[model samples]
Target: GAGVSQSPSNKVTEKGKDVELRCDPISGHTALYWYRQRLGQGLEFLIYFQGNSAPDKSGLPSDRFSAERTGESVSTLTIQRTQQEDSAVYLCASSEWTGRNQPQHFGDGTRLSIL
Candidate 1:
């Protein structure tokens, strides 16, 4: 795809289950980011990967959430022991660079529901 692509657009899982969300960034884009949006809420930054630099995971809400990007290609966001509060749309975005002024293009997002 020419833009960021995320799989499993909708997921339903029980509380305490673990889920893995995938994101494939646009080719040649050097910066990738993960964000989550709860119902009626704004997007929340989750993690970021830029080239070979160490990923900035400061946005992750807790240790149960983590993400990794191999080079500037695919990235995955894993959430362990899912809770009802974890239900949201997980969005992926990529940009040509990580500079403050760089614009990012976003994916449709994966909607996760915890039963």
Candidate 2:
């Protein structure tokens, strides 16, 4: 894909259900990020991966949230024991390895709803 690609564009699950969101970044993009946006709120950074270095998960909200990336290819965000507050748009973005100011290419995002 020319841009970031996310799966299950929309997902609806029970409150306690577990959900997984996937992201496939553009080829050659070594930097990837995951974020959550609540209604009328700004994007909340969740995790970041770059090259072979350890992923920076400092922004993960809780132990229930986790992410993994296979090299610089695909990434997955998993949420366990989902809560109603988890309803939001989960966005994925990727950028060339430049600097923090590098422009990011984002996906349409996965709309997750915990009912």
State which candidate has the highest lDDT: 1
True-structure lDDT of candidate 2:
0.94
Per-candidate clash tally: 0, 0
- For residues 66-105, what per-residue lDDT tens digits would candidate 2 score against the true structure? 9999998999999999999999999999999738789989
The estimated TM-scores of all candidates read 0.97, 0.97
lDDT of 1: 0.95
lDDT string for model 1 (7-89, tens) is 98999999999999999999999999999999999999999998999999989999999998888899999999999999999
**Residue-pair clashes, model 1:** 0
lDDT of 1 at 93: 96
**Stretches of model 1 off by over 4 angstroms after superposition:** none
Q: What is the C-alpha lDDT of each candidate?
A: 0.95, 0.94
